[model samples]
Target: MAAQGDKHKSISGLTPHEFITLNELEQIPEGFLAEHSANQMEYNDAKKKFAEICEDYGKILENGKKSQALEFAFKVIYDIEPEARSIKKVKQDKMWNFIFSSKGNDGESKRKICWIHTDKAVFKHSTNPKEIILTVKLASLLAIETWKMLIEHAQFMKIDKVLLTPSAGAIYSLKDIRFIAARIEGNQRNTTNIQKIINASCQPGGHLLAESNYSCALAAVLASTKDMKNEEVRVQIVSKVVKQYFVARKPLDVDKCRIWCQFAFDGNYRMLNNSDNDVLHKIFKYAQKNAQIIKLREVEF
Candidate 1:
């Protein structure tokens, strides 16, 4: 096995750190475990194929050396998707036209347009920069599902080969809450799948519905992405969440509550450049609402 931390450790006499993340393994998907388990036989076969490919290519000795075949073998055998691999981006050009009319058949039509292109093909017609941003936003709302599919694809080779960091698979690394929390903190874009998951967990009666917790958001994101659909293991997820919810008694004991606060109180203000005082004020308002609800409990006395 490739040595865990020491970059000097050898994989067939090659250091693993030359190609994989040193410690960011917690950002991967949860389905990796099941895929690894179900495909153990295939995984072993693929591992053998990978070793053969490495040996035949005479490239295993150079930890940084890479090729499609080698990459494919690692993806196939280990089911990891590294983001470092580069791929050609899709591109397109478009124009827009506008017309102002005051007379019949005699007015000249005015037009305004711009040409653009991008890496993702899902939004083929999104040529306007604003439109492209909107497309990404809308499409990203569907990220939970897309990410799930991506995770699954990495497992089965159902799609083209995906690159991966040799960081003990993606999901396993992401399980560390602190790491996910940091990603939330470091992200530049105001909106992201992680943010969405956090938001979902914070809404009233939302997946999280906690006052000062963080675990539910983590659990929800984990559960949602555990399979290709948030529904695959719905029963188990719900049961597990509900079980944990009641078992904790105090909402603070729930990890979900902390996840909510981390993003809500810390991530928004500290990471996203939002006004801390404003966010805190809003949070206080929400707290007052909760307090009001609790105050009404003694009316029958």
Candidate 2:
């Protein structure tokens, strides 16, 4: 039984730090717990913080006032689709809905969104650097708008935590968005309210459960299960593991990136293609080969 369990752990390619039991979760810092705990009291506090922030945000929007950077961002998005004035506009648009629909039986939608948002340029006719920059900027603005809409919708429904399906650009912006929430009514000083704004990029195989643009739904389902806390621990663990891999001069190929995301988010690797599978296998093999050099330590939850 011990050998079988070890084999399964090896096959899963998960380090000891990657899994967190309920008891382990209890030992996490109070600050971490406040932001991440799904307990009713903590969750309600997060919701109240979010509502206060949204109220402040409403005043800003009402006054036609925005930071210079935000003004630029809004302009860029409007340039892409003049009609995309708000999240509701994009959500109701037929084309946007189609683009964000489920990826069929396989998890192709996740990959498709990644490629389209990261690699595909909007102005195919122009190869100018300025045009390419504009295209990327527009995509990022749309992603932020989508995120805002999701937050508002969640608040209306009284949902406490939100999971985001972020583009590469959007992923980088998550910390900023969370900070915005923290700034509300001095919520930043309160450790418990800090992690209320959790976000993650869409893993390679996440579409099986969430399709494409419905990451908030996935968050709701996860919040209902004990796996939510485990998922948070796994994300922290895998992020450190991937960073270590990069520090060792390992190149992050597309397949490797996919594998890293899947492992980080506790995704179903079986839903990925054979190429991704091969990369995951290689990752485990490499970890074993360099175990002595890497000196990985178990992370406390």
Candidate 3:
């Protein structure tokens, strides 16, 4: 097992710091508990596979090395659509184009984004130069930093469209809130299937209604059972946000000069600390009626 603050991943998939947060929570959500078990299994499986990889590559001992050049390289080059991994970006009249597109006319839509789904990798065309490149290690922590940058200016906020990218898999990493083998669409060109999922998630006008966004968003941040301490988990927000940003032309531009947003209020972090006890119960049950998947905008800005 990896040590508390070491680079290695603990069996619970959380960092030593996260364990402290885990201990602070009062209630643990059921969905988070399910995800915690999945994370442990994923960690064990990765350990075994990584061992085989090291043995095959003749670096078993170096597996403990501080630098993970091989490990990180494998993840970057191993994306679903390697072709989309690297490409030149261009900006048109006040809008950036997803030039690496594989199909007919490029499609675009705008929608509200949730706090959880805020990764620049999903906005391939508008990735902020300052945004850290996505890697398996940083996927879970990406959003925290994204929001943290703005937190100083605005201490409280609300979010719509919590799901940032389209993905499906069984593993639970902080990235889905993290996924094991899920085909995440955040880092690549939105595939046909992924776009379909996003399309289904929005109104004809291409906007996400919070009516369905809050329930899943609520379910995502709840803590795990018995101090499951999944490091992949981000902090939870219980109150309705005072302000939220709509994804304008460029969500987060490298120049930091290409985006505009409509806004709304103040809410802070909280620990519900109850079992299966919903965080915002009345609201959760109502959002379930909509049952929509969280999604991000991908239309011509």
lDDT of 1: 0.29
Ranking by lDDT: 2, 1, 3
Locate the minimum summed-lDDT window of 10 residues in model 1. 1-10
User: Largest lDDT belongs to which candidate?
Assistant: 2
User: RMSD of each candidate?
Assistant: 22.2, 22.0, 22.4
lDDT of 1 by residue, 154-240 (tens): 334332222222321232223333445454455432223343344334222232222212343333333333343544354344333
Q: How high is the lDDT of residue 15 in model 1?
A: 28
Off by over 4 Å in 2: 1-245, 248-270, 291-301
TM-score of 2: 0.23
TM-score per model over all chains: 0.22, 0.23, 0.20
Off by more than 4 A, model 3: 1-212, 223-273, 276-278, 282-301
Give the TM-score comparing model 3 with the true structure, all chains together.
0.20
**Candidate with best TM-score:** 2
Please write out the lDDT profile of model 2 over residues 1-301, one tens digit for every residue: 0011111100111111121111021132344333222222332332333223222211222222222222222323333234333423444321221011223467664211111122223323223211112223223433343334434444544544433433222332333334434433345433222222222123221111111222221222222232444656644544343433333233334433442333233333224445334534554455455542332233222
Q: Residue 231 in model 1: shift from native, Å?
A: 6.8
**Candidate 1: residue 160 Cα off by (Å):** 28
Q: Which of 2 and 3 is ahead in lDDT?
A: 2
Q: What local distance difference test score does each model get?
A: 0.29, 0.30, 0.23
